[model samples]
Target: MTGAGGNPAPSLPGRFGPSFDVRTVVVEPGGSRVYDEAEWRGAIVLLERGRIELVCSDGGRRAFGRGDVLWLEGLPVRALHNPGREPAVLLAISRRPARR
Candidate 1:
């Protein structure tokens, strides 16, 4: 996925350009968490199993399940709405340069 004006999505893997950091994050089911954009850069949160509720900065919340891909924009993440019976595995990739 690309950003405004066709800018490529911030990611770590690449043929060229600055490489961003990548990490795996796991969220337990029936749990909710929040992270700011300053903390988490652009990331593709891949849902491995169970369910995850995603809440954007604009108060938008949605649930995603296994094999689902979620694009995390450089904005304040409100919460992770996971109301399932299992844990949720997420691959969080932070690729934005630190603010000076």
Candidate 2:
């Protein structure tokens, strides 16, 4: 994601384990970013505040606002755009298979 000054946002910091991980991200207004779908295979995204537009690989676009919960397992998310004037806060929860 890009910050207010057009600089890339700082890397998300979070704890990871064998089965799960969680991260919080904040996108500045007009900021746009992309993520590797394979890296987030079984994740769920929770929109905490503000608004964002999610664009899929097939060019489909969907807008989400505060309190919206999205499942990302099947959709190929190509990009995320913050369209609101305020920052957009989101929580990403990813589940992983148990390690052998």
Candidate 3:
């Protein structure tokens, strides 16, 4: 799905395996974080505080603030940037797929 800016929405990298995990991340203002496509294949991310910009491999960018949630499936995230003056906090969650 494309966001208001016409950038494709972030999606889970792949199908979740057989586990569930959650993590907290904090990024300072002007700081950026990068994730390898091979990692976080099927993860979900929640913005807990501040503002961040999600930049995709396709050159698409989207800004997200607190209360925003992102599903990292097909979204090729190149990097995440903190655009605000304050720090940005994020909650990352991943669940494994149910056994068939």
TM-score of each model, paired residue for residue: 0.60, 0.66, 0.66
For residues 1-100, write the lDDT of model 3, one tens digit per residue.
3322353333432233347655556677898888565555576788867899988888888999998998766677888899899878776777756779
Number of clashing residue pairs in every model?
2, 0, 9
Cand. 1 TM to true fold? 0.60
Give lDDT tens digits, candidate 1, residues 6-64. 54444523433355555556566577767655445566666656788778778987768
Best by lDDT: 2
Mark the 10 consecutive residues where model 3 has the least summed lDDT: 8-17
Worst 10 residues of 1 by lDDT: 8-17
In model 2, the clashing pairs are none
lDDT value for candidate 1? 0.64
The positional error of residue 44 in candidate 3, measured at the CA in angstroms, is 1.5
Q: Order the candidates by lDDT, highest first.
A: 2, 3, 1
Report lDDT (CA) for all predictions.
Answer: 0.64, 0.73, 0.71
RMSD of each: 9.9, 5.3, 10.6
